[model samples]
Target chain A: MAIAKICGTETEYGLRMLPPGDHNPVSISSLLVSSYVDEVQRQIDWDFEDESPGNDARGFSLESAMAPAVEAHLLNAVLANGSRYYVDHAHPELSTPECTDALELVRYDKAGEAILRRSMDAARRVLHEGASIVVYKNNSDGKGNSYGCHENYLMARSVPFAQIVHHVVPHFVSRQIFTGAGKIGSEARWWDRAEQAPHFQISQRADFFEEIVGLETTLKRPIVNTRDEPHADPQRYRRLHVIVGDANLSEVSTYLKVASTAIVLAMIEDGFFGEMDLTVENPVQAMHDVSADLELAKSFRLVSGRTVTALGIQWELLQLAKKYAAERGLDCVGGEERGSDALARWERTLELLEQDPSSLSRQLDWVAKLELLEAYRDRTGASWQDRRLAMLDLQYHDLRPERSLFARLDMERLTSDEDVDRAVREPPRGTRAWFRGTCLSRWPTQIVSANWDSLVFDVGSDPLRRVPMMDPLKGTADQVGALVAQAATPAELLRLLSE
Target chain B: MMPERELKKRSSASRQDEGDVAASAGAPPEAATAARQGERIKADLDDLLDEIDEVLEDNAEEFIRGYVQKGGE
Candidate 1:
């Protein structure tokens, strides 16, 4: 056994205010937090100190220069469980400390529910006072936009980055069925039919993202961040930095989403899952394909050079999930009945793909192409020089809500620097985080300001470990070489070198 | 027994005499005065009864409305 340990935390909530009327809803959240803080503190104190086998309560609080009146009024108190629930930016985020076991981690995560329930009760208490809080677990609103629900994982630097990517990428793309916090609008729209539900689905597209692989603290981040920040034993551990998921509401979904990836990575390391044939007709096209329709399946080559459908791999994983659930006496994986539905869908998809792979490929291609064309029209203008060429733009860069200089100009007119400057100042809400500084030159808010509080964990560990996964599509040969070079051992490097 | 009969006859005779005196006084007939007194008493009683009935009706309506609205029914 690799002695697996898993812990991560994030908050995904929507911003809402009372409509201008006699009722004021924004203040309600604050009032609610204040009223329930004492009760919540009492509950946490009982759970943490009173229930502990030993009365050892130290090394949790840190002194700060915050005004005492403000702190007391805000209920800025630390709990005995080594978890602090204090206001973060503007959101209430409950961050769990790295736990020794998965069960412990889940228990700590559940504490967030208790905290939220208390807060809601407090809100109801002062409902007459007038303030309402809106919670959103989505990354972006319906109209091709984005927000943040970050992920943090602890891993060992001893594990080769290449191996991690191979184990993690497929699961990352496929995990959306369980982990996706449903969406209301289409992700991609057709150019001619701009009004159609633009790629609207109820889940995060596992594929439509940028790949910037490095630890450099710049304005732009790699889609899969590998920056190592050791919070524990640095010599032995690495923390994987993930920043491309919509916050999920369902606890089971969140657990399955992260835990399944961790399990797959472990299996890959233990040689349980064989090497996958990772070749794609177009790596960018495939990513766009995956992003456009999560249900779309692709054929991946196995190490044996035999082509296997993505749906086939999912079926195999579903069987493993069934076995895991049975052994653990779990009613279902992630406490969800729908996990079985997902398994069934994969089985059905595999059978269909087995009958005819080409038809599936063509269908996926059509979807991918249509999404690309619509994304381009939305980004550029309606009168694109070559509608077919839009695929290049969609793959070359992520489609943000911002417009380029050429995009604003009439197809016939030339543009000036002033025109570009004005457009850049106030880019659309969905501009890519990477391009905000470079193109828009606007410093976007890095620290999210939420009304909810967060818990801080000092695990007393060394630097966090990070392993970068390769973009199955769009990653350059040099980038792949760099990742291969970072492998800890010769054997791992040799595998990639041979390839 | 003879004394009791005499007292009753005297009381009846006095009532008749009082009625004759009020009728002869010409303000109003004694029977009309009695009917007015009876009507006044009846109006007062009806007002009290109506007040009680309104209170009960209002309370019952409120209780039923509250029960159904709260999903109690």
Candidate 2:
């Protein structure tokens, strides 16, 4: 049986510094994060000592591959919500903590958005009247360059990486049918001819993929990223770093995106995908084709000599997932109850795509945005090449509540406002984040820094005390809530942890 | 906050139906609509476009042209 698929997401929002003094993204990105970190809680630096980005799953280390560093101007604050609000390259990135289930992932991810929104307000108060920062919960800035909304899932280190690469690519290529954040026209589009170019695409990240599988994320990007940083015991675990998805504005899109992928991963870990081969002949080409295919009828040849539409491929995967659920209970990827509900929603989503994709505008981001673009075109009789639709595309992802086109659409919500509000301040109670957050809130003055697997504490001794969290499932509010409450001090907590 | 838009869209939809009695395709046919939220968004599509047009930023094309970003992971 597969171990529990504890998962999370790291979203790097597209941002820009409006003109006045400096438009450099790095500086503005740092400012945006610092303002947020400054207001909510005392700064807790992210401990970078554990990061091993160079350690690859492909059996070789690119020692030259270095993780981004924290400079004086850049900020890397570990929030009390167990999220990392920091500057990643040029964008403000938020990494949610380990979530035991998909629903918890949604709430925490939304909390990241709310955090970014609040950061915008905080920055505006400090910036010159005309100079300000604008943030988009999106992937592209219309340039050839793109950022990422990466997903990380914990799986067995023994599960062969080759099997994961082969089985997961087809799903990643096709899942964009529902997971896309919607983009107007193609950036650095493959086809140059007017006839071959797409007016709009379902995915914002599809046009940027150039490889099927690799470790490189920014340059020569790959669909199935092989980043091997487990942030856990390496001998027992492997963290699957997925960089193919778009930064979603719709809560439904984000929910489905993470849930469906986590379920697929759980199946792979259990070897439930025995003898099932859904590999596309060319996954890179298939991803682009699926994204450009507005009619959802484009079919591509599979490695097995059968051609299947993206929707058809999803249906086959769903059928297998249902079988897996019956054979072995869905105790891994979110418990059986939530897992069953997620599968049902996945089935209904595919059915709607088959019958009439337009009917799902209220639940899918790409469809919702597509409908708005169509309405705009019908009213003004504009082409897909029109720039106004592009602005509309950008505005839909705006973080500001008043300006965000997505907020006005009344899209379906799986998490409540109260839950999102609480998620912003509090961590999910089911995971190790509860312990991390509770410690930070209780003894912010003594804690030095935090990482996924350890927390450093300054207990006023010559040496600092560090608490190691190796198991993502351990240190839950259930496990350590009372232990933390009774300690009353960092030194006492360290003593309890040692015991 | 949201009820205002819903009420306005519904009232205008009814008014358009009453006024479009002479025209065949001017108003969205009531009998042909689905009760899905999406179908309702389509039914009041005109009002949606109007609201969007009213709130859209000035000089949007230039703003989009200026929105360029660097590569990241």
Please name the candidate that would achieve the greatest TM-score relative to the true structure: 2
lDDT tens digits by residue: candidate 1, A1-499? 3324344555433333332233222243345445565544332211111111111111122233222343233334233333335443344444543333233334445444345545655655655566444332335433344445556565655776666555555555444444454432354433346454333342443323544333321223234545444343445655565655545433334545555554454454444454343433333333334444544454645455565455555556656655543444222122334334434444443454455422222122222223334444555464433422332322211111021111211111122334323322222111111111111121112111111111111122343212222111112233343643464443343345457
lDDT of each: 0.38, 0.85
By DockQ, who's the top model here?
2
Clash totals for all candidate models: 43, 0
Compared to the true structure, candidate 1 yields what TM-score? 0.45
Residue pairs with backbone overlap in model 2: none
lDDT of 2 at A454: 86
TM-score of chain B of each: 0.38, 0.42
In candidate 1 chain A, what residue range of length 10 has the lowest lDDT sum? Answer: A45-54
- lDDT score at residue A238, model 1, on the 0-100 scale: 57
